[model samples]
Target chain A: MTVENLNNINNNNAFKVPENYFDNFSQEIETRIFEENIKKQFGNKNPFKVPENYFKDFKSDISAKPKSNFAKIIRITKPWLSAAAGIIIIFTLWQFLLTGIENKNNQTGNNDSLKSKNNIVIANYQPEINTVDIKYLEPEINAYIDETDADQIYEDVNEDNNETKINSDDETVYQYFIDYADDNDYTELLAEL
Target chain B: MNAAASENKISEHISNKNFSEAFNLIVNQYKERLYWHIRKIVIIHEDADDVLQNTFIKVWRYLENFNQNSKIYTWLFRIATNEAITFINNKKKKEEESLGTYEHRLSDTLESDEYFDGDNAQLILQKAILKLPEKQRIVFNMKYFDEIKYGEMSKILETSTGALKASYHHAVKKIEKFVKQY
Candidate 1:
């Protein structure tokens, strides 16, 4: 069909919604919201909660002792700087989170989605990232990955673990991904990636 | 609703970092409005839900930057619309990348246990809507489902009322024809 005709088809339908379908949407949203709430309060992937000791960490006073000239700069830029930093941290964490998720999606071929007690298992067992961590026997996979690459990744994870002791449980998945990558045969390809 | 209480409630939410308070307040006030606005475009509850989450997340992220030049609710509606449009656009891109037509993707989605919202008629209407250009879809959604007047929408969207009204009419007529055909 022509573009005009398709537009006509869409205009003709105009997308009428079922009456009151949205009426109970508040309740459904509430349930999901509570889920988000629990996730946040427990520090389990809740995007709303900033961090523990946030008030203490973010506390600052310009007027209390601001004779210093540089403190003025700090005062003027505090809100903007903090907001920028928050955005950066959120973005960085999100990238790391998605990489973990993508690795999981590659492994096991979407099986865990059928069973989602909080949708947690989509990481860790993902063979692609795990293959990098775990030691592997396959020669073709060996030809693909250098054994040292997994060791470097392990070193990075150890550093990361020291910096942050307990993160959201997804780190458990990250841990598994590391282990899998260390042992898996195809880890060399991962280095190029 | 007491506007003062609502205002205080939002403030409390900001103070306590209580997202649920803000989320509940928004849902109580705007759930049906936002849902119908979203439902008109996406048609499926699941897609709507994902878009809705994006909308709320946008709200949470941007609430600190709210300028108060327009109502917060209107700003939220704009974000919701943008998110839905982006989602649909991305879905189309994904299908194209997978070497599938829109019809095939729709069937695959429907056959799956994931996205059906128990209303086939609603689905048909949304499929028709999927054909409209993004601007027409937005105008149609705001004017028809949400019953927003052109003037208010102009203020929200920073567009001419006449242009919006014309877009709405074109959108309406196209949808009417499509619905009539089915």
Candidate 2:
């Protein structure tokens, strides 16, 4: 077409700006720059990748790894197990204490019973001395009296108590012998006298 | 269950000396998140897996020492983050390279990695990220990819929020400039 005809004709090929294009031209350029900068720095892509099923198997892999001995022990020994062990130890100690106390009590009871039995024997034996035959003891008593020093016996009795004197009566002598002699020795001495 | 309730239950289980069960629960709950976090740091699937396992093993060893002062996930993240960083440092030491040289070499290896299935642009981004200072790189990945909040990150990285913000800002600027130049 001729130049004059082209100028008169409608030229749809001519460049045109969209509505308000210039109004936001600087803002638009800034936004594009921002986006382009971000894209250049950190493209919308993850460079790192994993083998397929890596995450799924990771747990098993970690679990399969051996643990430290202390960790293993910690894992194996539950709280209840430790508590139970503590309880058993305490119970064993309690039982030992109870058995010790019981044995001690048994020993004390035996000693007390032995003492009571000895006391009973002494009580039963006392009457036997009273029942001794005086007739069988008369000759021994005469011989003993012949060998004895009556003056020394009176002196010993006077030393025991200055307020009292040895009496010549047999009842007074027998009473003095009973008061001053051992159970078996007194019986023999009394029989001889 | 809510986080507090779940934490309380786990704490109860641990306190009750049910270590196996408690540990199992912990592993199931945190393995994926930790694996991803470690993977981003180490940049290799196998290394990530190893670091993740080490992190969990540490958790198993020190689970009793967890005072519950922070969220369980935050504590876990801390362990995972430290393990990843340690793994990288050890690798760098083994290679006998400076930090920048080792990171550059590691980024170079990403192309041949069988598990790295990413676009060229993504690879470029990752390489740019690796070129950053270690702390800045971590802060960027955690804040950018993981979108972990600054507060939570403070607990995990043991850095003050203000310092982390500054680090992140610097990292983003450096990364953008690098990517634009590339």
Candidate 3:
């Protein structure tokens, strides 16, 4: 080739690319750099596989199984069970108190009825003698008798009996009378009338 | 490791299957310059990308047997140049047959290489280089464009220094005639 012609290659400017061809190039090199990095990283990582303690945190969960169901019941239901026990105790105590009160009330009713009967029986018969000695009668009967003056009590009772004085003694003797009174009113006594 | 012996230690580490260390060394030493060099040769961003991958693959595969006889960059350049040449040859083979004469052959290569997105005169110059023989084309690229010394070029090409200088000179003369004509 001619040396004068060689001016063309030195004027080698002929084969130049666009102005910014190399300046503002694409990220291909960066991509290759990354690809190389990944290759390098994976190449190193491939040969290593350690026996790591993967399940360290799972120990508590495993241990808690089956036994934890029992424990959980205790944990979750402790307050509820305590509340139930408290309610049962309260109900039992309430029932017991109610039954005791009912029994006492029933006894009071029975004593009232017995006292009414005693009053009726005493009404029909007057005392045999005046100033009857209290020492002679049973203490229990005396207590049951309400410890009032017997003469005024029995007189008030029999005078209201409406007995027909058949004989002189009949007025003072035990009279046979029928009672048809709701409140044990001794005044309700009747002979034939 | 400490900087006390990072160079020798890093080189030793590269030989011990320590690819990460080798990669770090490659990045620090050759990354920017190699990228630009490749970018200039292949032109299109994507084609350069493909060539760069093939280049590194070759480098990694042949790293152990690397004689450590030359500059690491020259070793790398040989691989890059080989990959680029193979790619262009394959590309040329795939397309239609090139024109018979040297001048027409150069025109066909530049016209065919979609990556030759250069301005018109630059395109014409590249076309002229493509018309030369394969050895002349490589010598022309190393000397004219890359400004690489013929000594290093001789080492990478495994050619005698005298033959490289002659090839470069002949390539320059052809390119000069072509550029002036264009």
Could you say which candidate leads in TM-score? 2
Q: Which candidate number has the best DockQ?
A: 2
Better of 1 and 3 by lDDT: 1
In model 3, the runs with Cα more than 4 Å from the true position are A1-193, B1-10, B15-17, B39-43, B99-118
Residue range B1-182, candidate 1, lDDT tens digits: 76557656765664554443454576556655565577556655656655665565456445545654556666767887777777776676645544335534554455343434435555555555556777887776565445677777886677886567557656655665675666
Alpha-carbon RMSD of each model: 22.1, 36.4, 50.6
Instruction: Give model 2's docking category.
Output: incorrect
Candidate lDDT scores, in order, read 0.48, 0.62, 0.45
What does candidate 3's lDDT look like per residue over B18-107, in tens digits? 543454465445544565556545444455545555565456445546665455667777788777666655555445456434335445
Q: What is the lDDT of residue B47 in candidate 2?
A: 81
lDDT of 2 by residue, A29-54 (tens): 55446446876555656667888998
Q: Judged by lDDT relative to the true structure, which candidate is superior, 2 or 3?
A: 2
Error of 1 at B54 (Å): 1.7
The list of candidate 2 runs beyond 4 A from truth reads A1-36, A39-41, A60-193, B1-5
Q: Which pairs in model 3 have colliding backbones?
A: A8-B176, A9-A12, A9-B176, A14-B121, A14-B122, A15-B122, A16-B122
Q: List, residue by residue over A1-193, the lDDT tens digit for candidate 3.
A: 9998888778766577655546434443443343343334222121111124412221211112223232333354323222222222223334445544232213323322111222212222322211011111223223423454434434434455555322223222223212222233321111000
